[model samples]
Target: MADNLLELDTPVIAILRAPTAARFAEVTAVLQESGITAVEFTLTSEGALDALRDCADFAYPIGVGTVRTAEDANRAVDAGAAYLITPVVSDEVIHEGYRLSIPVISGAFTPTEIHRAWVAGSTMIKVFPASLGGPDYLRALRAPLPDIPLVPTGGVTHDAAKAYLDAGATALGIGSPLIGDACTGGDLNALRDRALALREELK
Candidate 1:
């Protein structure tokens, strides 16, 4: 499972927060077509689990985010999520996710929290609100903790993705900028075009 997580060749991880299952599927299709092979559906999104199940056949990996409890982790696993991501670190959630042999990306904002998540068995340390400090922050954190795999999420734009990768980020989780309100508005073609442009920029 860890290998699978690491095998996500594309650096961009789309964060989808649609309000309906149909919109989620449509957005996911657009992203997948654009070469983005990993996506996250936050639990706050309505019918997120069902959408995950609905897209189970897609070659791309599907994940759950904002998971704060072991129960939520289990729900994601049962729904066939390829991985689990949290907005914050939680030992119980990490341990439980590991027991199920699913990769976990636990969110953290500080050096201590990032290291703690790594020690707790997180597959990757997600630097939440990464735009606040940008690449310089990740570069500084990695100086002492070079071995920890870090993925920067939140407020990441196409240009920011390159900066994060240059700053030693193992991967990126892109929201709004990649999978935006165009999904809710039923403009899948626009979303697809945006995803394609993002993929090209990452390339």
Candidate 2:
């Protein structure tokens, strides 16, 4: 499954971090038209798993984010998530994801954490708060560990998306920049536009 996911080489994972989950479907509908097929629902959001279940059958992949525990991983898997994402590297969650055959994107910053996450069986590494280091940071990480796939999250805008990818990021995790106010305000067209524009840049 991890290989299958990598093969998708999805340009971005549209992230929803709202306090409410009602708009999951709405945002998804708009993103779908723009060819944004990978989405992540943060556990910090209310009813995150419920939102996942609601859209489990969608044509795209749905991932659970902010997963910090084995229980969270289990719940996310039970909710039918295709993959799991963590804000911090959690070996328990990574092990759980491995057992479930679900890819876990463990978050890390320093080279030590990133390498540790990879050595601990993380399916991939997420460079959290990636904006602080930006593409240059990723370039540095890739210098010694070019084989480990990295996913950059936080402060990754459409304009900066390609730079990270070029720096060796296997994919991106775009949050509000992708979701924007469209989820709550029902202006999903904004998200559609962003998604479409991003796809154009990535392509």
- TM agreement with the true structure for every prediction: 0.95, 0.96
Q: List the residue pairs that clash in candidate 2.
A: none
lDDT string, candidate 2, 10-68, tens digits? 57878888878888877886787688877888888898888888886687768889999
In model 1, pairs of residues that clash are: none
Query: What is every candidate's alpha-carbon RMSD to the true fold?
Result: 1.3, 1.2
lDDT of 1 by residue, 31-142 (tens): 8777887888889888899988988888776889989999999998899888899999999889998899888999999999998999999999899989999999999999
10 residues in a row with least lDDT, candidate 2: 1-10
The residue ranges of model 2 lying beyond 4 angstroms of the native Cα positions read none
How much is 112 displaced in model 1, in angstroms?
A: 0.4
